[model samples]
Target chain A: MDNPNLGGEPGSLSPGITVLIPAYNEAESISDTVNSLLAQTVQPAAIIVVDDCSTDGTAEVARAAGATVVRPPKNTGSKAGAQNFALPLVETVWTMAIDADTTLAFDAVEKLMVALDEKEVAAASGFVVPRYVRTVWERGRYVEYLFAFSFLKPVQDFFGKPLIASGCFSAYRTDALRALGGWSNRTMTEDIDLTWRFYFAGWQVRFVPDAVSYPIEPHDFKFMRKQLRRWSHGFVQNVRLHWRRVLAVPTLRMIVAVAAWDAMVASLALVVLLPLMIVLFSAPILMVAYVADLPVVLAPILLGAIRRRETARALASIPGFLVLRAVNAFFLLEAIWSELIVGRPLRLYEKGH
Target chain B: MGIPVITAISVIFYILMALTILPILRAVQAIRRSPRGAGRPHVFPLPVLAFLMLIGIVGGAWVVATLAVYRLAEVVPNVRGLLPADGAEFVLLGIGAVSMVGTLILVLSAVEVLSWFCAEREPKHARGPDGQKVRPTDLIQGGVHSGRPHG
Candidate 1:
C-alpha cells in the first residue's frame, strides 16, 4: 500500500471531516470514488481506504487515486466489519462512509455538512440515484430512489425520523459514532442498525436532499436477487432487534408499523388474495386492484421526476418498477418466512453490486 | 405521516365514480382532452389519462355488477332479507371500506405531498470546529495525515 500522502491536488484536504471507503475487489471503480471525494467542495481532512483483504489489487488502485490505503489482516466478512476496522482511526469531527463504487456531486459533502449544523443530529444521509439507468433492475431502483428520496424521506425528515441514513453515502459526528461503538454488524444492514441506535440513544439523523451520490446498482437479475435478499432480511432483522426500542419512539414506531404492514400484509394480499379472488369469483376485473393505487402513486412520482427534469425517464421506468415490486413482494415474504416463521436468519453479507 | 388533502380528494373521486359511474368516465375523458389556459399546469399527462381510462373502465364494470346485484335483491325477497342494508347503502358501504383501506396505505405519501407545501426548516445545532480555521499542518500533526510518500 502507498503512504497516506495527499494524492489528488496538493491542497485539497480540509479540516474537520475524514472520509472512509471500505473496498473489496473494487479496483475498477475505486479511483472514481476516491477522486470524487478529493474533488468535494468542502474537502475531507483525510481519506482512508480499508482494502479488506481483497484478492484483487483494490488497495493499489485506491492508493494511486489519493486515498490512504490500509488492509485488514484478513477479510472483515461484511461491510460493517470493514468499516468498523477503520472507525478507530477517524480523528476528525465528522466521519463519512461511501461505497467504493459510489461517486458524489461536487457539493454533496458541503450540503451534508449543513445538516450536522444541528447539534442534535448524530448523522446525515443524502439522496441516492443509481449511477446507471440502462438495465431494468437499475431503472426500477432509480424510480424507487426518486420516489423515496423526493417524497417519503422528506416527510420522514420533517417528522424527525428519516427511516435510515442510507449506507452507501452518509456522514456522522465522530464522537457520536464512537459513543455508539461504530456501525453494528448484528443485522444485514449496518447503516440502518446504527441509525436506529442513534434514535434509541436520543440522537437525530437528517436527510439532506441536496447532498446526492450515485452508486452502481445491480444490472442483472442474479446480482439484484442477492441485493434484494440482503435488504429484505435486513429490514426484518432490524424490526425484530429494535421492536421494543422502536415502540418507545412514537413516530418511528408508526413508521416501522406501516412498513411492516406494507411488507407483510399488503404483499400477502397482492400475492395471495388477488389470485384467489380472481379464481373464486371469476372476476378478472379484480386484477385492477394490483394497479388501483396508480392514481396516487403516479402523482408523487411525476412530481419528483419533474423536479429532477426526468419525467420521460420516470415514465419509461414505470413498467420496471411494477416488475420490481412483484419481485420485492416475493422476497419480503420469503424473508418473513425464513426469519420469523422458520427461525432461520441470513447472517452472511455478500456484495451484489 | 399525516393524511393530506389529496387522500380526501381521491376518496371523493371514487365516491363520485360510484354515484354516477359510466357518465363520470366519459366526463373524465372529455375533461382530460379539453384545452386549458396557456399558463395553466398540465395536471394530467397522456399516460396518466390513459391509466385513468383503464381504471374507469374497470371501476365501471364493478359498479354495473353492483347494480345487477341490487336489481336481483329487489326481485328476490330472500336475497333482500339476507342483505344487512339496502342496495344503495351496501354499495356506499363497499366504497367506504375501500376508501378507508386506500387511506391507510396512502397516508405516508399524502403527508409527503403535503410537506411540499409546508417547508419546515432544520434547526441549527451547536457550532462545531471551523474547518477553515485548521491548517493542513495542524491536520498532519494529528497523526492521521502523512504529508510525504513512504520509502
Candidate 2:
C-alpha cells in the first residue's frame, strides 16, 4: 500500500480523507479491514487504527500492516471512546469512521464523499449488510437490515432526517465532528447518539444505500442476546436522553417517538397480548392476529431477497426472522424494564460477538 | 353483548384501529415535521399514496362484507336463532367485519411491501437559505439548514 499522504486541494479525490478504524481484539480482522480501505478507489489521506488497549496483538498487527496505530493508555470502554482517542490526530478535512471488523465497498468512500460536498450533510453513512448468512441470527439480522435500509431508511432520508448516519462506515467533516465533541460516550450506541446530535444542531445526515459496508454479525444466541440488549437499551436510552431536543426537530421527534412506542407496544402486542387473548378467550378467529402482518413483513423480505436474487434464502429466513422478532421482543422488553422501569443504567460495555 | 364478550370485542376493535392508525399517523407526522411544505411529504410519496389507497379499499371491502353478512344472518334460520337479542345483528356485524378487515389488511400490507424494492440510492441535495452552500461546519456554528436531509 503506497502511503497515501494525498494532497488536499479543491477537486482532489479524497484530498483530506482520513479513515479511523476503532478496534479491540480485532487482530483476526483488523489487517483485512485496513487492506480494503487502502484498496479503495479514493485513498484516504491517512488510516489511523485505534486499538483501544486490546490485549491481543491488534495494535501490533495494524501497525505492521502500515496503518498508523494508536492505542490509548487505558481501555476507552467502548467503540466510541476508542474512536475519540484518534480525533485530535486527524489533520484532514474529512474523517471516515470504520469498525475494525467491517469492510467497505471499493467505491463506498467515493459515494459517501458526494454527501460531504453538500454543506448540510454533516455525516454520510453507507448501508450495512452482513457478510455471512449462515446463522439464524445472521439471517434474521439480514432481513431486519434489508427492511430497515430498503424501506425505512429511504423514508427517513426523504424527510432529510435519517435516524442514524450509521457508525460502521460513515464519513463526517472533521471540523464538524470536533464541534459536536466527537463520538459521545453518553450512549452505548455512539453512532446513533452522534447522528441525532447532528440533526438537533441543524446538520444534515445522509444515508447512501449504494455505498455498502459488510460487517460480521453475531451468529449464535448468546452473542445475539448481548447485542440486542445493548441495542435495545441504547435506543430507549437515547429516546429518554434526547426527547426534548428531538421534539425541536419535527420529523426526527415524530419518527423516534413512534419508533419508541412501537418498540414498547409491539412487543406487548405480539408476545404477550396475542397468546393471552387466544388462551383465555378461546377465540379461534383471533388467530388472525398472529399472521395478520404476514404480508407486511413478507413483502419487504421477499422483495429484498428477489432483488438480491436470494428468494429461497429469504423464504428460509422468514421463519428465522419470526423467531428473532419474538426473541427481540423479550430482550427489548427486558431492556425497557431495566432502563426505564427499574431505572438501572447498563454501564458495562459488553462486546456483542 | 355478554360482559366477557364485550371486553373481547373492545380489545379487538381498539387493537385493529391502532394498527390501522399508527402508520397513517406516522405518515402525516412525517409530513408535518418535514422541512418541505405540506404539498408533499416523503411518507405520502406516490408509492405510499398507492399503498394508502389499497388499505382504504381493504377497509371499504370489510364494511361491505360485514353488511352482507349481517343481512345474510337475518334470512338464515340457524344464524338468526344464534342472535337472541335486539342488537345481536349489530354485534354479529362487528365481529364479522373486523375479521374480514384483518384479513384484507394482511393481504394488502403484503402488496404494499412488495411494491418497495431496491432503491437507486442516489443522494438528492437541496440548498439552504439565500442559496448559499451550508456545510456541516456551518451547521455547527448554527447554519440555516432545512429539515429534509439528502434524500
* Alpha carbon lDDT of each predicted model: 0.74, 0.71
Off by over 4 Å in 2: A1-14, A283-288, B1-151
Residue B105 error for model 1, in Å?
9.0
CA shift of A71, model 2, Å: 0.4
What DockQ class does candidate 2 belong to? Answer: incorrect
Clashing pairs in 2: A119-B134, A119-B135, A160-B148, A160-B149, A295-B110
Q: After superposition, how far is residue B124 of candidate 1 from its true place, in Å?
A: 39
Model 2 lDDT per residue over A1-353, tens place: 01122223323333478999989999999988998888888888999999888888999999987899888899988888888878777888898999888988898888778768877778988788888888889988888888787667766776687888887889998777777778877777888888998887789898777788999898999999889888888888888887667656666765675566557766766677667865765543344444445545565556657867988887877767777888998877888889899899787878887
Error of 1 at A199 (Å): 0.7
CA-based DockQ, model 1? 0.03
Candidate 1 structure quality by residue, lDDT tens digits, A41-97: 998999999999998899999989999998889998999888888877776778899
> For this target, which candidate reaches the highest lDDT against the unseen true structure?
1
Q: For residues B28-128, write the lDDT of model 2, one tens digit per residue.
A: 44553554223455453533553453354333333333334446667876655544344443344345435544544554443334333322232344456
> How much is the lDDT of residue B61 in candidate 1?
38
